[model samples]
Every structure is written in C-alpha cells, then in structure tokens.
Target: MPDSHLHEPRDSTLVDLHQDLPDAARLKRLGVVIAVGAVIIAGAGIAWRSHSVGTETVTAHAAAVSDVAVVHPAPAAPTDDLVLPGQVQAWNSAAINARTNGYVRSWLADIGDHVHTGQPLAVLDAPEVDQALAQAEADYQTALANRSLAATTATRWTQLLTQDAVSKQETDEKQGDLAAKTAVANAALANVKRLRAMQGFERVLAPFDGVVTARAAQIGALVVTGNLNAQPLFTVADVHRMRIYVHVPQTYSAMLHPGIVASLDLPEYPGRTFSATLVRTAGAVDVQSGSVLVELQSDNTDRQLKPGAFTQVHFHAAGSVGTMTLPGTAILYGNDGPSIAVVGADGKVTVRLVKIIRDDGNVVRVTGALNTGDAVIDSPPDAIHNGQNVHVTQVLPAVTAAKAGARAK
Candidate 1:
C-alpha cells in the first residue's frame, strides 16, 4: 500500500515468471544430455580394451602349443654281441663192431674208459675158426707128402726112359701126375694162409684215441663177422674238442666265417662260458629251415661238456656295420618296410623308411637315410601327420631310449 509504483504491473510479473521456468527446464535437459554422452563414451572405451587384451592372450596361447617333443637318433656303436642257439656234438666219433663171427668175449674197455688207437677193446674166442685152421693145416701136410712122392716117381720114370727101360708114353704120363700133385699142394697152402688171416681178427681194437660212450659187448653175446644188420660192440667219441652246430638264419649267414671267435653257454654249467671258433659252414642253405649250418669248435680238454647237449653261442658282429639303433616303440611296420618319425629343422614331422638290421627284443639296429644328429620323435601321436608343426619338449639319449623300449615290453 505504501509503494504502489514498486509493485509493478501484473503482465510484467507473469512474463518474467514464464522466462525463468523455460530457462530452468533447458538447464535440466542439458545436464541430462551430458550425463548420457559420458556413459556411452566410458562403455565404448572399456569394450575396446577388453577385446584387445583377449586377442593378445589367444595369439600367445596358440604360439606356445605349436611345438612337440622329439629325440635324436642314436648312433651305431661297435662291440655288440649276438646270442644264438646251437647244438654240441663230438669232434670225432666212431662205432666199433666185431669183425669176425664168434662167441661174445670179455671186453677190456667199458663205457667212459679212455683208449688209444689200436688198443684192445675186447677178445672173442672162436671155436669154429680154430677147427677150420686145424683142418686146413692137416690138408696142407698131406698134400706136401704126396707132392714129394710124385717128384721121386717122375725122376725114376725119366731115368728109365733114358735107359730104354720104359716107353716114351709111360714116361710122359708119370711127369703129368707129378705136376698135378704139385698144383694140389700149392692150393692147400693157399687155403691155410686164408684161414690164418681170418683167425687174426678175433681181437677187437680201438680205431682212435677216444672215450667209450657205449658198450654192447658181454660174456655170452654173439659177435658178427660183417657189420651189416649188426649192433656195434662199442661207441667211441674223441671229445677233446666239441663241435657246435648252429643253424643260423639266412640273414646272419654273412657274419659267419672260419676263425670267427665265439663263446658257448651250456645249460649243464650255468654262468659258465667256453671259448669257441667258427670252423666251417655247410656251404649250402637248408631248404627246409631256410638257414645255414655253421660248425663251431670248442675246446673240451676237461671233458666237462658232452655231445648232443644244447648250447648257446655268442657271436660278436661288427656293430659299426649294424650301426644305427632305435627304440622299438619308434618303429612302424608297413608294406613298404619299417619306418620312423623324424622331425626336420623347420619344426615339421617327416616319415622316413628304415631297414632293420637286427632285432634284440628291445632295441633294433637300423640302416636308413637318417644321421646320428637327426631329431626323431618318440611315441609320436597318431594325430601327427607329415609336415605338421610340433613343439620340441625333450631330447633323450639313444641309450635312454633303448632302456625305455625294454621297459615298454
């Protein structure tokens, strides 16, 4: 009421109020737009950072798992020995039989008795031979007496013919009779000599220095003159040296030769080994066994080893020739022959063909286009193929791999 001018007009007051309301509303809308823009920008930056980190982590993991473990091929070494089965036999063997027919005589030598050449083994008493010799001697004496009488008669007949006391025809007849008697005496002497020779064979003798392995002679056993269809009186074997017969497979035939040194193992003497030498070969392949018959001579001076016994022969072959060796686990058998997995310098896998020279149950000797430094894969995964990338984990020594192969069995 005191200041009517200060109160102002109502329309002016209303206009000011409306302008203030519009300004307030515009300020609120601007604040909302700024807040929305900030939220969108923050979300975009977080999403970009997460994507980059995930991509980097994925790339690192792929690179780390790309390599495979591998091993180097073992170099071939010398001094490898091979063991094979063999049979032992006597170096020299013989069967002694009776030469003349007679009753069984007492044997001087028995089984396990050592005898020298021409030593008496047995003596046979032949009653029939004695009687035959007596008869032949008597006939020879009678023939000798007749020949003497005929000679005297022929001399008298010749003298009479000279004195003309008898005819020429009669003298000729006397001479013919004397000649016939002389021929009879010569035949009788020959028969006596033949009988004497047969009598000398009653004593059976040893043919060589050896031990008697068998004895069939007895006090009452009958002895046969001929060897046909007759059992031997004694079996002798010269065991100073033993013969080892080994039927080596054809694959190892080339390693056998005269003078090759070897060792023998016998079941009778466990842990004992005897020295031997490869003496000879059968020179031909056995069609049935597809093997070569090799003869090895071993010294048996102590007579501890016997013939027909089984033995194992050890043969030392050139390890250098057989050289490259690998674990059996690394080998693969196929129609193209044996193969192995080898890794190249480029971190890729390669399949290589190899020849197995010898198989010693656990490890095998191989010959191939691989070097000693070649990195070979051990226990390769079936999923691995040629030219596949691998990560090298460990390289094992050849000896270690060989041991592993044995354990795998």
Candidate 2:
C-alpha cells in the first residue's frame, strides 16, 4: 500500500515541479489551454444528449398517429322508403276499319278528331254494290207486274168454275196459279228490302266515342274487307283514361294483389306523381323473362295523358313493419360480395354481411346484424379487412357537400 502511495506522489511531484519555475509561464498558458479544452468537452456532451432526447420525442409522436377515414354510428331501427319506376298506356284502344269492300270516296274525320258513337267516319263509293242493287230492283218490279196479271186471270177463272163452265181439274189449276203469283209478289218485296240493307254498308261509322289517332286511307283509295292487305282506316283511342302496364319481376309477383293502390309518373313532369289502381294481372307468367304482367288504371279526364307515351308506375307495396332503410351511397360493392365496416368499441373495424330485399335507385331496404348509432364506414374500404385494429375520427356524410360535421347534434 505504501509503495502504491509513493508511486502516486512521485507523479504528483513531477507535475508540481514542472508547473513551478522557468516553465511556470509555459505552465500558466498550458493550464489555461487545459481548462478551455475541458469546457469544450463538457459542452459537446450536453449538446449531444439534448439532440438525442429531441429525436426520441419526435419518433414517439409519429408512431401514435395515422391518417384514416372516420365515421359515426347510426340507430338500430331503420325506416327508409323504397321507390321503383314504371310506364303508362291507354285503357281502351281499337283500330277503326271498313266493313265492306269499296273505295273511300271521302274521309269525314282525321287524326285527333273526336267523334261520338255511330258518327259517320267516312263515305265509301261502292259502284259494284250499286249495280247489284239496280238489277235486284228491276227484277222485283217485273215480278210485281207478273203477279198482278196472274191474280186477275185467276179471279175470272174462279167465276167460271162457280157456274160449272170449267172442270174440277181446271179450277184447281187456276187456284194454284193465284197462290204462286202471291208468293212471287212476297218474294219481290223481300228482295227489294235485302238490296236496300246491302246498300247501307257504304257508310263508315264510329263504333264508340273516341279520338281518331291514326288515318291510313285517303279519298279514292280502295279498302278491302277483313284484315287482308288493307289496314284499318283509322285507330281510335278512348283518352278519357289510361292504363299502365308493367312487367314486374317474378320475385315480387307474390306481393301483388288486384285492387292495390299505385302511382304513375312521367319524365316530363319530374317529381310529380299520379295515383292509380291495380285492376288485374295477366294471369300467366312470362317464360322467357320470368316476370308477371301487372295492369294499373289511371284517370285522365283532362286528356293530359296520351296513349303510347312512356310513363313510370309506382307500385305502393305493403312495406315491412319494422324495416330500416340505408343510403345506397354508403353500401360498398366488393369482389367477395357486399360488406360494410363497423368500428367496434375497441377501435377495431369489423365487417358485416347484409340481405338486400329491394334495390331502387337511391335508397335500399336491408336486413343485417347492425343497429342505430353504430358507426359504419359509408363506402367499402380498399385493402381494409374485417376485425382489423383502427383509429377512427368522424368523417363527412357520404356524397354530401359538407366538411366534417357532427351528426349527433
């Protein structure tokens, strides 16, 4: 221990002597340099420690943060309406036609002309019918003259028979002649009446009260009987009311019943609707389309609704009692099937499957394992998964022109 202490002192002594004389001035300058060097070393260590602490703080802050879309929960009870589109048509329609074979001498009506029942629609020039009538009339006249002469001769013969001037056979012959003449006269009268009735076919009359919607024949044009090469001279439609026919998908066929209330809409009158009533069904389903034909009736007393105009029909079905409606914009279309994200209480995202009953244009009615006030991501996420950990913030309402606004308020 003493030797160790002596070695330490000898080093001190050499240092003290070196610091004392001749080199004292040099020692003073050296002392100042050594103090300054110590100061620079201490400052460097302090600065390095401060810089390290700052770097650690910045890293911790970055790790705690993330950029994500946020959303809020909705109520469990949902009540949304479902809407669908449809078209309109006429209730009663018929193609007015010519019943007799003749030429159209004059058209008394045109398109949009409203006519009453039995109104003369057109005049037909039946030259052949006229000639036939003339022949029949001349034959009737000759028959009448012959019948008159036979009756006078039979009267004279009967008087002679009463005086026993003629035999029984002769008398019988005279009586037969009178009877034959009377039958001929009666036949002539029948013939004349039949000919007159046939001539009446030259006039075209409206079967019912309606507007003429089509005109195919002009004056001097040949019109044929039956549905042959000759088309109908005109098409008449009763525009006082209209019918809307729709082919509803077979899935909804069961829900439909006759006499159900419905509505009609025209694109020309956006956002407006006309009430209608379900009259009947086509009774059979279409094989190719898998749809059922539904007929609805509408009143058009003002004549505002025209036949052949395309219009939409809204079938007011009996909505589910406790159903909920969701904005379609919030529903996400995905590859594995449709799904929506729900942020759990633990800040983790969980996806859920939904059953869609009907898909209209804007809103949808759905049934799923979700409730009101449950924050669900409006749109499906990209590369996002079910049961994933997440940090959620309130996001803007989907498809709305708004910044982040609290929906709870």
Candidate 3:
C-alpha cells in the first residue's frame, strides 16, 4: 500500500535522490581514510632516510694537496752517490807547542810561511839547558877517570893477592870499589846525553811539510812546555791532502763504511765539484743528534780544496734499485689507512690500500697492485670516492728551476 501511494511522490525526485545517496556516502568515508594514511606514510619515510647509512649526506672541505711524479726504486747496482753539508778541512792539522820552558830569542817563521818538514819555526835562548849539559859532561868525565883508576887498582890488587902481597879481604874491597865506580860513570854519561839531547828542543821544528798558520811566540818571551790547555805557538796542516768532515744522519750510519765514493761541493765554488772518498766515520749514531760523524779525504795536490770552507757531499749507496714513482698527491693518507684511487680499464675508480717506501718531496715511492703503464690521477680532489666514474686528463706543466725552487721553499 505504501509503494502504491509512493506513486503520489514525484518520479523524478525518487530517481535522482536514491540513485546518488549510497555512492556519495561511500566516497566521503574513503577520502578521509586516504588522507590520513598518506600523512603517516610520509612521516615514516622521512625517519627512515635520516637513520640509514646509504643515504645522501654532505661533508666539509678536506686538506689541500699537490701531485708528484712517480719513478721506480733504485737498483742494486753500484751508482754515484752524494751527501749534504760537508766541510772542507786540512788533511793533517798539527798544533806545534813549546816542548820546553824558555824565553823566545827569535821567531824564524810566521803564519802563512811555507815550510819543510824540519824547517825551524822559532828559537829559544835556553842557556840554562846548555849549562846543565856542560856540567853533566864534566861530571861524566871525572867519573870516567875515576872508573879507569879504580879498574887499574882492582887489577893490581888482584895480582898482589894472588902473590900473597895483599890480603884477600883487601883485594875483595878493591874489586867492589871498581864495580861501583864503573856504574857511577855509566849513569853520569847517560845523564849527560839526556841533557844534551834537550838542548836542541830550544828550536821549534816543523813536524811535517805544511804551512805555519799561527805565531804566538815572540823574541824575549818566556814559554812553557807541555801546557796542553794553552794555544799552540804554531799550527801546521798538510796541504797535499784535505779532509772533509760531515755529520751524517744516524739512520744512514749503518750504510757507511771506511771506504766509499761520494761527490763534494764547496759553497765558495758553486759550480765546481770535487771527488771525495769516505775515509772513516764515527761508526755509531749519536743519541742526541740522531746522526753520525764522517771523515772524507780528497787529493788536493793542485791545491784546489781549501780548509774551513763549508761544502756539500753526495753519497752513493750500494744495492739501490729504483721503483715506479708517482706524484705524492696520489697517496691519500687518512685516519682510516693509506690508500690510492685507481682508475680501472672500464673508466671506473677503485681505491686500494698500499705501502709507501720513501717519500721524496716531489714523488712518493710506493708498491702495490699497480702496473707501470697504469693511468694515475694527479692532484686529485677529496670529493672523489670509490666506485666513482671519472674522466682522466693528463695535466703536466713545464717546470722551471725557479718553479722547482718555489716548491722546495
């Protein structure tokens, strides 16, 4: 009955309102759920990205660096060598001192005077020594006379005792006296010789063929002998050969021996270099300086080398084989470890750990899984990473001596 009465309702109203009611209500609920779910999902995504390690992150600036050329290690064959900071010195420096105390009567030579081995340098008025020698000689003469007399007397007494003219006891006494006189004579003669020998000490003679570098003695001056603490009156150095002393680093002490070849340079002569051979060394390193002292000698018959001049030395080490050298910039030293960034055949970057042997300012010597022909990145920036695709460009600038000097500075 109600359905029949619905005929009274408008047919257009029933059709329109009923058809849209169910769909409109369902669509409203669905929109609200979708909005809430979208916001929750977005918050979770932000949290996840923040804690993950593989996510994008930014870093600060890294240390600035330079690149160096790589070369091979030194071979084990003998090669020319050198050292730094050497000194030019005399082969033999002799300080002539007064052997006896006396007044200087006259000086025969002064500084810079060329002298022979036995050339007289100075003269002393040692009359006291001469007088002592004379007195000793007189005493020795008297002793000899007495000894001769005693010998004759002893011989006469022995003959008299054999003939029973003198008593045995008396002959024994004479024999003893003779022997005593002979001993006294011999001692007196020895004293005379010693005093005579000292007479020549008044004259100072050159110890060897050299130059007189000093003159402290003057006429009428009193000098003392064996005063080691005082300065010498004359200094003589052998000019034929020169000694170059250098303080080698202690780390290289073990590598040096008595005989080794090296090159030497003097500051006075910038372009001239002389051949120097290692003569001797301290054989041990100093605890304080971490260095060893080495002595070298060079032939200077032409008088080319001079003493008291500063010089440089270059030492050749034995068994030095070279290695493939690269610029120091290629080595990336960090708290993590020592590593290098290498480019693969596929144009990709692969960082590897390596061992560095030596670092010469311009080049860093290293050994690893690198080949000689491999392309290395010079002066790489810190932004590079492992497994990165990179384009390599070989950049080499013509370096001058001035530029090298700046880098060294």
lDDT of each: 0.82, 0.71, 0.73
TM-score attained by model 3: 0.66
Which candidate, 2 or 3, has the higher lDDT?
A: 3
Where does candidate 3 stray beyond 4 Å?
Answer: 1-83, 251-261, 316-319, 324-406
Clashes in candidate 2: how many? Answer: 16
> Highest lDDT: which candidate?
1
In candidate 2, stretches whose alpha carbon ends up further than 4 angstroms from where it belongs are: 1-87, 145-194, 320-409
lDDT string, candidate 1, 1-409, tens digits: 5888657766533334234467778788678989999999999999999999999999986774455556566766665566789988898999888767898778899999999999999888888888999999999999999999999999999999999999999999889999999999999999999888778778888989999999988987888666688778999999999999999887677666788889988888999899998989998899999999999888899998897899889987666463677776677776778788888878778888898776665677788888788887877765556787777878876753347446777
lDDT of 3: 0.73
Judge candidate 1 against the unseen true structure and give its global Cα lDDT, from 0 to 1: 0.82
Ranking of all candidate structures by their lDDT, best first: 1, 3, 2
Q: In model 2, what lDDT does residue 205 have? A: 80
TM-score of each: 0.63, 0.55, 0.66
lDDT of 3 at 177: 96
* Cα lDDT, model 1, residue 311: 86
